[model samples]
Target: SSFETKEEQEEKMEKSEQAAAAFPPSFSVSEIKNKQRRHLMFMKFKQEKRKQKLQLKKKKKKEREALGDKAPPKEVPKTIENQRVYDETTVNPEDEEVAFDEGTDEFCSYFNGLTNPKVLITTSDRPRGRTVRFCEQLATVIPNAYVYYRRGLALKRVVPQCIARNFTYVMVVNEDRKVPNGLVLCHLPDGPTAHFKVSSVRLRKEMKRRGKEPTEHSPEVILNNFSTRLGHSIGRLFAALFPQDPQFVGRQVATFHNQRDFIFFRFHRYIFKNEKKVGIQELGPRFTLKLRSLQKGTFDSKFGEYEWVLKVSLSAVTVFFKMQEELCCLI
Candidate 1:
């Protein structure tokens, strides 16, 4: 009877071992009291995860290969631009009212070739270091651009003087802690001013693999992804910065690319190496601009009417309530 009891105990122990093997211990590395053991377990867990991921990828590849041409198309990763909500303000080319508005806007004269662009570049009072260089470099990029000292004058006063001098555009670069941080672009005589928060300013000296000094020839301006009515207005504002006629001989290009409400400015020089192959080299002084507000008139912060102002403080749920208030009178 003792021998039989011992054999039964051994059989139970074997069954317990098999059951334990079937369902492995459930645990986390954090539960381990030993530091070294915890680290080792964590590394093993990471390796296991990676292994599983690789195996799954391999399985998917095999399935795709087996399906061949019949396989469903690969899913495209979602991005803010691709997944953006339907915008009611998108410009339609056939809209006559929009055409009329554009035809009579402040930058219309420049677009119509009736008046040449004369940009007066100035900085915030007492600009130092990079801010000064940024203005100088901006002047170099834009044709007929003149750099002027701010002299601690009020923008309202400077505006009238600029109008008297026949300057079409006034660009004021604002700096903080000796770093260029803001920009104000005002179209003259009539109105329509844009304020932008500037960031990621990469000057010529800071760039790597930059091309030689840009030529004096007027560069071709390219505005990309400006689809909405507001975007179209912003695009035109930048387009009016340069002369309409571009010098093909210069091979220089200035691109203002808008994506997810941020405007990225890039300068480059391109060369046609072959019929199909072309090479481009970057010319430096690149920066990013996020629009703060677009005003209907000149730089009057007090009385100017805003066409659009970026709402950062409001939550997404408040948008519907805000829209309802705007449509209250009509309702």
Candidate 2:
């Protein structure tokens, strides 16, 4: 029986060895831990790569800001800075300074010639150059000067045909659309150049009725577009219809400068009335000359001389706009 027991034990040991030999050495606990560590290291490396990309983007933005750059990706509508006024010069800078500093910050004061029942703008500073800046100047001079205009024959012309009379002031804005939150009260002249305060509800209703949205930035764009349009339209019309006229009107274009002020930023129509064989400074419409000192809320009302400066400025702006317009057209 002892011998048989010994044989049985040997047989059991052999079976156990065979089962162990059938399987190759498996992964150790330490090996599995090492594999996991390698994966985590790779994950950390990828995270660092992504962090570097983000850091690069931030650095680029900071560099751009340091270089005084602005984002050029916003879509905008037409504005009021585009418009026209007569050409004149020799503006008394003193008057402009005084008005801006001392006068009430309103536009309606410019249109002082309003009658009790009728209206007409009569600011010391006749608006010139960019219509929007002119309006702003007028507002700065007057308390509540306004410029209002509506196209087509549907809207009834105001009772005070011009821009003056009883409650506040109104002027014919000559613009295509009403400005949102815009307020320009002026004593408007008769005919087309009128201004009025638009009732919010009415303006909203009109926009809704026409299935159009009020501009998010209409004041600046509408005015600017108007001036540009006027410039182009006048240029085309004069070229086509009045080609034979001796004293010709040049292409209409609004000019601007980087004065950082409202007037400086405004785009003005460059009206160059020319005379055959006449030099640039030697020709212009005959306007009554007036001189006055600047006061608070008032300035050199030399808007009549706007044309002279425009002609001079055109030499510079023409190049910028020519290429720009062509590009815009292509786009």
> Root-mean-square deviation of each candidate, in angstroms?
6.6, 24.3
Per-candidate TM-scores read 0.81, 0.20
Local distance difference test values of all predictions, in order: 0.92, 0.32
Candidate 1 local lDDT, 1-331, one digit each (tens):
5667887999999999996564323866598899997887778777777988999989999999999999889989998778989898898867999889888888788878999999999999999989999999999899999999999999999999999999989999999999999999999988789999999999999999999999999999999989899999999999988999999999999999998889999999999999999999999789999999999988998999999999888777798889888899678
Count backbone clashes in candidate 2.
70
Off by over 4 Å in 2: 1-51, 55-101, 104-164, 175-331
**Candidate 1 ranges beyond 4 A from true positions:** 1-25, 33-40, 273-277, 314-331
Which is the leading candidate under lDDT? 1
RMSD, candidate 2, Å: 24.3
Number of backbone collisions per candidate: 0, 70
